[model samples]
Target chain A: MKAIHHIEKQTGKAFKLKKGAFLTVIDPMGQQVSDMVLFNSHDVNEKLSSGKSLDFEESILLTKGHFLWSNRSNKMVKIIEDTNGRNDFLLAPCSKETFEIMYNYKGYHPSCLENLYTNLKPFGLSMDDIPTAFNIFMNVQFDQKGKLSVLPPTSKGGDYIKFEAQMDLLVALTACSAEDSNGGRFKPIHYIIEE
Target chain B: MKAIHHIEKQTGKAFKLKKGAFLTVIDPMGQQVSDMVLFNSHDVNEKLSSGKSLDFEESILLTKGHFLWSNRSNKMVKIIEDTNGRNDFLLAPCSKETFEIMYNYKGYHPSCLENLYTNLKPFGLSMDDIPTAFNIFMNVQFDQKGKLSVLPPTSKGGDYIKFEAQMDLLVALTACSAEDSNGGRFKPIHYIIEE
Candidate 1:
């Protein structure tokens, strides 16, 4: 087991996960959300695909035993364990525009998209390269009419989900910046990569 | 009215539309789908955004009177008329991987992603630049549990959706190739850009 890494509120981290290694994302403060994106370290173009994962999984509620698939139709990671099962793949990462348009705030705001691109820039990723993220611990519900609503996470402190990487992967993770996503208060998120 | 431009079955086209021009996407034959992507002509970085459109519109089913929004929180186009009210923005443009993974086909296959990148190349758009398209006449249904299913388009011949460009735009259109999306057959799509 490796030491836990902490991602401060409204911030992000980018790292590489070896094939077969376990990566566990922990909502240490509960009610907070984390956004995570993955790419094949070997070929960045073969990145995580929300549409493919949702299509192949056959359910929007992806949990334990379901695989996260890539744009190239390859499995990237498998969820081995889930303490809090609700996550969202339906929405893109929040950005500055999200706050202005949705929240009606006009000033500088930290956003998951900004956090992600800033941290991933070292890996040669750009704003346009970011995709719809796999939002861990974020609860998004949809009605029969397909209207979506973001709700506070149902996780308690120390809740986590564990995944086993299927290939060498570049992963970006963020402590979500949207107030609506984190019950109106941002909190730090923690992760551990087990060798 | 300008002459109708035909996009061959399982193929695509790309062009530019001046601001205030009307672009009507027509399902010339029944039960076909067209995937459309829009980019700001002056700044490709500010392109159509599915999440922002869904968030701002507050509905997954966008029709007449709903505006397609950009990543930068600007309205890119306004849907002024819709004869076939159903459309989908929840899914990405189908790619070769879609056939291999979902349909279990091995050989080469036509795909919206390929058509988009091919036609959009002259506009300086690459494969990675393609975003989740606004799927005209594509009927995608979701269950109460959030599971999604692609159903046959409900459009009849001559059904069309008209959009007034809110900005000078670079547009890509694809006559979709996925069998499930078009109810087991492919058909050409038609468009007219009127000043």
Candidate 2:
């Protein structure tokens, strides 16, 4: 695997990947989360749909061998490898409001929503350019009664997940800014794209 | 209120409004759901955030006297009048996958996600344009244990909800296409923009 890009903590970045390329995200600090969004390279209209992907995989939790499906198009990417299986698809990306409402903290806190909009602007995209994301390494769990909670990631440092692009894709990722429910600090993540 | 535009049943439409204009959705045939999304008129990037709105209103159910807040810009719209108080902000707009997965029916299905995208295209907006919607007139209840279930709308025929725009807004609405969980039929909704 060749390292193509390195995303800093509490920031976002975007890249284009050709079909068959492998994209990997590494949690360098163990407990951080990566909020990832995918778009069709040829047509920005289609995007990775967590709802569709979950339905396609017929599972509540994403795992190796499951396909990530776009809302308009079918399969867009496939998860072929995973070192930490604690990713979450149920939660929306964190925003300024999330910080203000959930934690009572205020004043320009780092947010995945802002990071995504800022990073995707070079591609001429805005906040209205993507759907909800796949929050990799963020541990969120729901009980049988439907109550949900976010938990500290169970991944260790150096853990990662790899996906194979099934089509030309534009990917955006945010090293999440919010502290874990357990008050774990956010950290940087590294990425690799293999030809 | 003078009618400016009328939306047919199971279809979607978009309109632009200056601050203070009132938008009303009428359940003409009753027991139908209208999935609605709102965006900033000057910048499509900012959108109505159900989470933010819920937090601002400090309630789970949207009713008369509540404000609909935007994710970035804060308050966007206000529910000034509501003939039927039953509404939802927790559930996402239904999609083809929702029907296929929940109903075991596999075929083209009318979805709020597709309808919203199709109607907003003329405005150069797409699926990424908005967040989860305000499901007007859709009755969703949660038990003490947090289990949720969709119920037939409590709205009667000709009942409606009216909102006063707090900002210049771009609004998209879909007369929901999925059957009410209780096997209630979907019906058309009439919309009026009062100057």
Candidate 3:
């Protein structure tokens, strides 16, 4: 199958998917991470909720057969297939604040939050509107004490996860920019949307 | 010292604290939970960020001497004391969807999200502005596989946690409406703000 679209390393893309369509996010290069956020096309106020999904799914690691629920209790998408099973919903997408505070960087940096808002701006979503994202191919672990740590993804080249839209949706996806998230190397992300 | 105020069962309150003021949240009844959210008084855009605080503090279990950071990478408050040490920042405040989807309750229900937004409206905040809250005395445990569970709070009656505001702040506190979070019972939350 041919990929209809691809996001370059450290960048993002935004688009709309009709109800019943399928979206496949591909890690074209090994260990790259993609951050994805979804909003109901008919009502932007009803967006993806990490809390709801976690509560309903009863698991922190989401994968094939799990449904991503919205803040309004609606199912936005259902994972139909997942070759790379580890995804993170606990952390918000990396931002400029992430670099400044965590990485100790002093200057402007490309971040998932910036990429998401910029790409979604044409769809009228602002910076504050961004929610905790479904981080694909991202590895996050927690200790018994509930302390979280970001680790390099385990996905290999050509690995992908596919989701079937449960409703008409506006989607934003990022080729994550955080060095820690991508195992210290940048790589492109590929995706295909099919009816 | 007397409690400045109290939040009734399943209710919420909003207040402001000057910089350097200490705010204490008390679990007057053991096993009850309170959710807290903070905003910068001078700039609402710079509000509490779980990711930042978790990153800077290097722990998910925030306790005494830890500082809560904002989205702007500025300190908002420092945990001065913690008698009930387990606080949760991983979950968003329980909302109407939480009831409908998780509990399978069909009718209208009280929720932390509604209480927070209603109480905070006077301060120019809306439902969308609410972020993931800091759940005081909420016992959330995760396993080695990352599966999370909400357990009854380990706090005893009269246990309290105190924070010193690093900057002037607008705060919203809730006597959490979620049944599981509070061990299947509703109870009040007490708080005091001191110079």
Candidate 4:
């Protein structure tokens, strides 16, 4: 329920966007993301809430990008941009395979995503059916042929898109696998979610 | 080797720093971080590969101001500004106390630091000695009496205090726990690790 203004310091101009407007993501980098996925819930069905642990059925239902939910408000939060790549963050899913690949698998933290699953599985969630999601910052671009591949990000400080969430949604995001050397060293990204 | 220049885009100025700099961060805003915690890793002695997991030591070390660390190249990375009021970060460690205070124990994430310790105990780590970290970007400040308290950040994009990592240290960082309500949520941030 607060208002955020997008100001470009270079020109000292600001864009006063509509509060609770739809989400709009813009990819300025001009590239494609590999295996980038989008998932939505059916707001009309109203299958999710803060207390409800997400399930395979609910996750699968979200495949069409239409199993809509709401935030605290009835307004919408847009998936404005996939600035960098289009991959669904490469379901690497933090496995021992990942540990072995990254750190010789000799000594893993034992608490990667796989460990998360082993712990959370008791609550009725399944990673197998984890809905593919749009990688927010990673970029995946398309060629003229629409061939999917990873690309660099077109987003910067002043560059941003807008969107509206039709309903209150519980969003799950995996920052990214700490594999590649992009994203300028996993520095913090400040997200300005507004009303 | 690559050099990361913290560029102040508006003024066209840059702080050209080498890779692996010793960065001392401060949280101006001592706000209750609902999401992630930030910190200033004054010095992490464990060895680190280019991309690897940081072994957070059990004891918390408060990196004093003006402390210095040298890299493999023997380059100096000084703590130019070890302590500032939370320019744009919160200074809080991740713990059950932090969670209880911030979220009011309303909800519990199984993976919280408290839980992280339970799982890590088997690995010879305990909750008392898990990790001590500063909440970067959330804002914390020092009063005239030198009292540490949380505040809002005063940092703009590209306005970073640079330090050369005295050595290749495994650093694990995530975006702050703030939203677009403030100046966050748009672009997470661009922290380049120039090697």
For lDDT, the strongest prediction is 1
**Every model's DockQ:** 0.52, 0.14, 0.51, 0.01
TM-score of chain B of each: 0.99, 0.95, 0.98, 0.44
Q: Pick the winner on DockQ between candidates 1 and 2.
A: 1
**Across residues A1-195, which tens digit of lDDT does each residue of candidate 2 receive?**
355577887898888989999999988868888889998989877787754565446455786887888865368889999999878775667888788877888688988888988988888787756566888888766554344667888888999999999999999998898885323686787899897
Alpha-carbon shift of residue B164 in model 4 (angstroms) = 0.6
Best by DockQ: 1
DockQ order of candidates, top first: 1, 3, 2, 4
Model 3, B14-56: lDDT tens per residue?
9999999999999997898999999998778778877667766
lDDT of 3 by residue, A88-181 (tens): 8877788988887787898989999999999999988888778779999999877877667889999999999999999999999999999998
True contacts kept of each: 0.47, 0.04, 0.47, 0.00
- The regions of model 3 sitting more than 4 angstroms off are A1-3, B1-3
Indicate the DockQ of the complex predicted as candidate 1: 0.52
CA-based DockQ, model 2: 0.14
Q: How far in Å is the alpha carbon of A80 misplaced in model 2?
A: 4.5
lDDT (Cα, tens digit) per residue for candidate 1, span A21-140: 999999998999999999999888878877678778877788899999887678999999999999988788999988887888989999999999999999998897788889999998
- Model 2 C-alpha RMSD vs. true structure (Å) is 4.9
lDDT of 2 by residue, B1-195 (tens): 475466776788888988998898898877889989998989877887654565445466778888888767368889999998888776667877678766887889888888998989988886656567888998876653333577888888899999999999999998898886323686777888886
